[model samples]
Target: MKPQHPSVRRISECFLKPDIECLPQESKQPYYLSHWDLNLLPIQYIQKGLLFRKPSEAFEDGHPFMATLLHRLKRSLSSALFHFYPLSGRLASIINEHQASILVYVDCVNTPGAKFTHAALDLTISHLLSPVDVPLVVHSLFDPDLHTAVNYDGHTLPLLSIQVTELLDGIFIGSSFNHSIGDGTSHWNFFKTWSEIFQSLPPDGDDIVSISRPPIRKRWFPDGHGPIINLPFTHSDQFKIRFKAPELRERIFHFTKESIAALKAKANAECGSEEISSFQAMSALVWRSITRARRQPQNQITICRMVANNRAKLEVPTSEDYFGNVITTLKVSAKAGEVVEGGLGWAAWKLHEAVVDNTKEKFREAVEQWFECPCTFRLDQIFVTNSLSMTSSPKFNIYGNEFGMGKAVAVRSGCANKFDGKVSSYPGYEGGGSVDLEIALFPHNMANLEADSEFMSAVSSPPHLFHQ
Candidate 1:
């Protein structure tokens, strides 16, 4: 093993006295939980990989690397909050009440001699799951004891008792995290930071740069807010739904930067309007896809809600990298049939109008007003569009999320079980040339969606998009 870097040592020491003040405070209202407080639970799941013969041989000296990794983990674990530590009885209680709290275990099988590589892990996980629960933690309340872990089967290093099956030899690091901590980006940032520290590398200097503070105690509802309606849980009755499917429930698609530019030009030409954004273009594609899947009439007023982070727009500087939710939702409604009939360019223009047209202040005001009342509002679907630049090695290093093994293949937001649909976008594979989209819809809806030719063609076409 290599010596721990000076900076890495400093980071390990810092966790020993983690600044609680750095974490956001929970509001007093019954349901007004801070993103930090809600996502504090840590659920553990495992990621497995294979080790090469040479690397295995190099570790012939009795499990020394395992000991060192454990030592560092113990030190770091001691520094952070112990709230996520599962109480034997409490864990059972949660399992009984919210059966959905069951953790998801993902296995990444690699060929032997396959050293653990960051890019491979990213691709594997990206192809497997979206960061579903990570994003939900921003808005939902969570108990502690949420985490994921990985278990290794074969190895030359005796980290743990290596139990081999007929197939592969590799490492499994259990990933445990509280959903309420932060968005997928924030969680990935933490994992990347941990990995860098483990590898004895300097943490990215700009990674921890400060952003605006979030408004802590604003009244969400000043005047009397009224008639909050809770939508029925369409698929809640079927709790046995599998996490991944032979065919995905929702398809993820992307458009290249150039493609988006071309779409905008086409939209302008057709609608006699100004240029639109990539987000709008993508949204238009999805809206059309959904309508085609549902075969709904043109007059149906379908709604598309876009999720926007309000950290920068707030009066105070929000903790940009803070672990909890700091987002507000905005809705755009159009006749479903009209959108599909009007063509992708028209729908894209509508989406653009809904997004860029809104003032920053309007978003702030909407957030303030939401908290003014105690109403629990729900929506049909949400779309999260962000730059993939976030996951780049220099910008954010998820590969460094070392729990003993190496980094994760994919880190995604929680599945959208609460609503009719959920969608998220990450940076495209190569640079910022394109984007990767993940969509989650009700299972039945997903089945209907997969059979649609138009939707399938769009997904399989030039840019390429599909459900994970």
Candidate 2:
């Protein structure tokens, strides 16, 4: 078999804003952000995509095939923005010298609008997914300029960019969204709405699409601190950094339902308790395997900064569709030897306890502390640290997002916020509680993990799962 070199050529670029007539009066004003939203470095954007198999309709050429779909995509997305209006807004700063603080907000009045791009990939779906590892060419499917940066760029750059790349037998809808606006739930919710609208569009295209699960457009905040809160910094430039990441290799490993159950059973048997969940067991397995692969010093600390959604933990729980960032990173650390020798049960137990301890009270206390004195994130030291960050939960509905064409064939992410020791988990395409981990590591560490017998023992070869 020959290696594939995917050739991507741009067709068109445009900015799509929310329909002003459909926009509620409340959304027309400056939308303030929560501390949960502002806590992240403004430069980071969540870049991911969904691949849809080619439609059943026949066409003489690829250009006309795309030309037909583009009309429908634009209409549905514009309708999606009507509910997710804040995504089209720009990030603005308001400095108050007397208060000695700066306020960051979504400047709805001056929205640059979301960037929409159409492109052609001279390749087939099989050619795209033939590799054991995620192909590097997949990154080119997105707008490259919006990678890891402080969200402050929203002042000028489009806050969201959706690139539609048409392949021979499939189409990949890649989106670059600023992290300042929301988390994984918010990101997927936008896509879910867009797909639903696309499927529901009437032939005439005259009626406004009614939202079945309308987004909770209002942002979340603790009492008295917001609807509007000021950051400790006076200038946005203080958050900027020349973030240079090490060249890391990315590969995905698939865990079957049987394998996940086996891992959970093993961890529970070792702990003599059934409290260990499948997620914990699988995460622990990765942590231990990666620690061994890195060959960190026996006495050195190994931490898994597990990212958890804080939506349900809030004192006054908001709806699941809350349209903002509500998340926290909890750490579970142990000596490298302990993590390796303690067996999967011990590591999993630690993770389960940390998750249980992240109560709403704990989250609120952390927020209040941030209110006293704020600190921004610096991405330069991410790869240098001896810690690993687990992002994207398998619970997210990655496989269920269906446009008029069909449900996604495979989900892929871009090269943003990517560094050594970054493990992103997604539910397998086949469903039934299977898991797929998109893992990244330095070249040598990745090689060691690829060859690690214990890690490879539970991973299964994937099947051909894509369809129209």
Candidate 3:
């Protein structure tokens, strides 16, 4: 379902670079999908927010401020897309002669440019900053859905869709991409480059190199890799997932530098491990709190799973611009009773151990092993396995995305992701040791989690106030 906003209006729609001659169609390149990319289902969108300058700038020659700003953004974006052309391409699968298997690869030949839209809402920045949870208008800023192989109709949808919305105080820049292309790091890499173009187009004319570099096409294929396994996805299957307005609530909980330090101290003291990281401590606390709130049986086992990036962990040398998915999941399990009864350090140790176990060599070995027996790893399949899934990396420079105007005042996950037990994390908008946590859960479970004594004790007051 699409989000309806009374004041929202579309200004214009155009390809990133309308001039076809400027970007000649290059020879078709067949890029094979990695093991990580093939296993995960493509259902989610990677939405990012960028805050721009205020509307108070005096219009030179009395021209409208929004019109000038939109023109500038579109021009800069076109330049950026010229370098990142693969992003404008679509993903397609080549069927085998047996019709029993498919070869999934990104189709970069004869593809159209990315989709860019200019839009505005009749709202002020105050309306967005005042909400503890991100306002719904933010979700409506970009296209609501992500492109999937099942729904790909040759040339219907572009791989990327960028929307720039003008607000009373500042502008909202949002980009939605299919999750198959890249993970959070790759997504931020593109944003940072686009921002560089926005600030100043490179003098060399080829903005790709100086502007975060073009994506590396060298595929990562291991020995003994199995054939691609196809999953059954029907047209009606997309509609199977539905939710009502009252089903869940999305909220951002802020953990300040002081609070996180204190939590770290408590967890470290309890576990007696000096190597425990902030992510481990925080994730443990969240997992324990949610399990307690759910009031599950004491004997039940609660699992915590996080998508770990394998870029740096890989044995082979990957360029800084190596794009596409390079991530695998790390799972930690503990009895509900232990998580609820144990100190923060106990839970932190389990998580930290699980994370540390996946070293560079370990990741390569795992990928090679998965090739022996490839299977569809769907997100919904986690319920049967029983785990709390986490996406996005806290290390990502999400708030540091300065696009000439200024750094974003706040950042958030999309509201469409307000599903039970899903967690997304970003660096605090304030850019301190703090962390911003976006949690989506059922209304009653959210209420219980918020009311958890230990959890609230670590939550900062007023929830990290957003500032310009």
Candidate 4:
């Protein structure tokens, strides 16, 4: 049945630049894109949002309330940008004099500012949480126009666009960032900082407190890798088709501390090793269930690609505040029959080994190998066949983001960069080893996977209904 919810309608739009102009002496040249950033050039923008119950102090949702919100948000965001100034800039590129290389950079000098939008939705928190699957309307909470736009689109569009939506009894802060500018670490860092600043404001005064983690503008490069890596294409027209993402049904599976602990224990017992982490056990269960759901041929190969962070493994230690992508993908494969019949523990042990092999030396080698040909990730790798990939980390403090409102009621993602077999995991609101796995799969596979008894046994849902 069609979701019984109101459509979102845009009300206002504006740019929020740095509150204080940066000094030219302090100003600098264009910030070059790292090879890690370039590898995601074909990917779509990262559009995600944090939902909150309506603020405790009640006021009419008329122009006065929204107008005040727009004013305060713009101010707080502008202040936040002073530290994360690159987000306010536009994407700029220049072809070398020899015309052999195309260099992409962020024009920090211009400081184009992040986009802030105000929209209205006559929907309630209940409308979102009651659904078995995420309501389709939830996707539109972020701007609809940029839903499928790739990362390179940052050249013409605002590098960062945030939509502050007013719901019937809640608010949704939807953010869309240029994927090349940052990964989930950089993304949430900005949000967490903004929240801190927003909460510190005194409604009328702008005494923004210092943020916990400031942006670290240093982009990482492996030794011998070019500080000035060039794109093969001279013109933007040639940088196309990173890969097409498939539209799939998405469902959020909640694994409480108890459920995850049990899954981990079982996995360790089966492998005769107590080292299987909760994440690996959960991944194994999901992978095995998904393979069963697809009903692939017995001998068909299936792969699980997990994104690993390189902040600690960088040739040099990278602060978590570094404002760019610093991660790589790790893959584990087995035939469909082997994965399905191996039992959760056996499959999890395989995953544990993959994680252990991702050492600092191994990461440096991968970076060097990339410079050899220099290519971005493609869909055929993990999405086109009996394969799946995981991104985002449960360790991220997404639930802690509070912009004067209470802690986030839930975490959600937009439609961009999503495809069949893509999974995003978050630390469950209840915390303490709990996890929320947002899995995307072919519509048929989703239905079948949900029916798998072994999978459903550890799953919990219907996110606790919100109260303002």
Candidate 5:
């Protein structure tokens, strides 16, 4: 039976509004303006699901759930435009007039377990529905394609493919904006909101949510610290250098709280130092793993970049929800030989010192200095560890983010692929207190890192690791 709830015409009527006269004025922060520009393009990508069908049931009626989802999407888009200007920004460009196509791909000639299908969807639906605008939460067909599956040596290997179209599972959705309007967190928030609305839940009321406000005063003029790293216009001949195989990459890793605590204890004991947060300890382990995998001798400088959310640190308005990319990068450099010979505990202490010493004021100064400096110095990699202390866990039910489909299995940043260095984070995993640690790196580097015995042993052994 077809699910019927709201009329698309009524939803459209609710959303239509007069267009803004002009684009918002660009801020002095070049990074801010760059994000604005990126947000204008309709990005795309594919999301796969393993669909279970009963033997007595036939898929001839098509996916009613998906159909209902589309109907709700159209209505939500219209209502969103009527209620919020930012929502309108998502639909300014119409990529497809009708509902997006859904394609089914059969595996193993006529296997009975489950069927695989791809739905062409737009980021607009995901954006307006989520609770935050974190780039990772904005699922669409336009996001970059990372790789393709290939069979080799009795194992399926991923082939690097920068071609976005090939990455599509014959599904597409349209929306207007580039990568700049919001980050992964913002996108996730939007999806949660949309889901709530779709399920007839209370629309995001004006709750007293703590959002970072925009800067009240201009801090300094641009000092040309380095050239801006803009997205490349030319396509690389070999995708290997540009894209990493997504399958081989474990997007998320599970670790129990107890195990994490034990690792921290071990790290503190080895360093002969005071206690450090789990983030710092895990970062040390990752750094050791990466350096060891590369087999670089001691004394060679390896960089670890840490991402800091500047919502509270910026001189922005207290009321403003300092949205978009309010993130700053902090770098820690150490010799591979020092880490290898000294062990992870020593590395953890050094990392702790570097990160703690560069708190709020120091970060503010670093940003100012970067704007003033003329030299470009990009870190080789990044380590991010988000605790439940900041963002509410999906299990907490602090916000009704279930868009008829329940909360996401995982959430991450979309911008991870854009950097030369790897980006890793630990979001709360399912199964209660355990957490999922996500890591991204270049293919060759990731392959080497996975082969290390010490790192693998530690990751696979009793205390620290849990297979997700």
Candidate 6:
């Protein structure tokens, strides 16, 4: 694909103040992390799109619609931040004496405000809606450098950063956040709250409580665990292997309701069980297809790591509004030859079994074991060297967030630079039971997967391939 060059102008950048005048200040307020959070010790922020098509009314008059829209957006976001105070704060490190050395504790403290970067581009909404390469289009819509940074001493970057770009006939709202603060569920809740506040003004104005589920500041600690402040985790020496995904390209593949049903039927027939879900079927199909495309050695293992939402499954119930990460990875694997010989049904059953195996008791046991060690995560060691992993749940109501405008046309994950075999799934923009899979693979592998007739069969093409 030929490279695309577009002009993006940085209009203005500033820190928007929260609407609340006073915030409760505890000299040292610590936020506890679950075993799941510690495992993903250092994760790139969740960067995704909140795309809005051009409004119907033309702006031929002297009024500048872009400026007006931005002003309204800024105002509403300020109000939303008042409810999500943690996002407006920063993560601080507390050093205390442990055994022979020092221990570091990351506490949520200080308000530096979320960074807001506003820019405009010459590109049109059609360019984004059309069939364009992921890098060219997505890179321009978002600021790739906008992510939280952590130093060795544990001094961390801001919890949140947002970029609002104005494209001709569309608006792109991009957000990135520190994973230590929350997970996808928390991310979506903040956006949903912002949208509600934006859509409907508080009856008493911005002074009253508006969010449906304002986040709870209190952190949960399991039994036998007291105010655990120190994090002894460290990245493994095999860090290079964790990010070994080479020169890769990304493509968005769509699966319609019919295609999903066909996959489920075939998987169920193969397993001789009607209990396989659409997600399980789709996951199985993709895993098998990718393994085939990669054409790994027969003795090698092909693994699939599915990220599970542990909110409802946790032994202790966390408030729906509880802030912080509550997720874990469920892994299934087979020898490369085993996967090739077993077919889609075999792969799907493996995935289904893994999900069922993560019972509440198992989750509790895992947490209990984590306390015994409590070391920081070494990302590369978490999963098998060349395994495939998927994040971002399809259950998140990303499409429903409408900030006084219409629903977003699409959603995207910002971890574009991740290693190969990383995939994120979101509900398709089109309504029927469908899903959009964002896949990242080495260039040759991607080309091979695209050419595979069986894999390509379920993928729906874009409406207009306007590329010249």
- What candidate 5 gets wrong by more than 4 Å, as runs, is 1-63, 77-179, 201-251, 316-320, 370-400, 410-421, 431-433, 441-448, 458-468
Error of 1 at 177 (Å): 4.5
TM-score between model 2 and native? 0.96
Per TM-score, the best of the predicted structures is 2
Q: How many clashes in candidate 6?
A: 2
Q: Report every candidate's CA lDDT.
A: 0.37, 0.84, 0.68, 0.82, 0.38, 0.69
Name the lDDT value of residue 385 in candidate 3. 29
Model with the higher TM-score, candidate 1 or 6: 6
Q: List model 1 lDDT by residue over 1-468, tens digit each.
A: 632211100111111222333333321112223322222222111111121111243256575754454455433332222111110001101122343332211111111111111111112222133332222221111111111111111111111111111101223233323232234444454444444444542233312222122222321222343112111222222221212212224444545666656655766777777767556666676677766666667676777766555556645555545444455445677787777789877877777777675667786566555444312221111222210111111124333345544323333332222233555565543335455565655566666667766555544332211221
RMSD of each: 13.7, 2.0, 4.0, 2.2, 14.6, 3.6
A best-first ranking of the candidates according to their TM-score comes to 2, 4, 6, 3, 5, 1
Give per-model TM-scores.
0.53, 0.96, 0.87, 0.94, 0.55, 0.89
Backbone atom clashes (below 3 Å) for every candidate: 60, 5, 0, 1, 67, 2
- Rank order by lDDT, top first? 2, 4, 6, 3, 5, 1
lDDT of 6: 0.69
Task: Give the per-residue lDDT digits (tens) of candidate 6, residues 1-468.
Answer: 675658678777776546434555542365554555544544555677777776655346775777767776777777777777667665554444344222333443445567788998877766665553465456555555542332221234556777888877677898876665678888888888878877776534444345677776565667767455455523222121223234667888888888999999999999899988898999987887888889888889888989887777655676667777778789887898878778889989999999999999998888888777665555555534457887787777888888655777667655533557878888777656788888888787888788888789977863232221
Name the candidate, 1 or 6, with the larger lDDT value.
6
Q: Model 6: which residue pairs collide?
A: 233-375, 233-376
Which digits, one per residue and each the tens of the lDDT, describe model 3 over residues 150-243? 2233234676788888876677888876666666777888787777777775434643334546656455666544234342333323322333
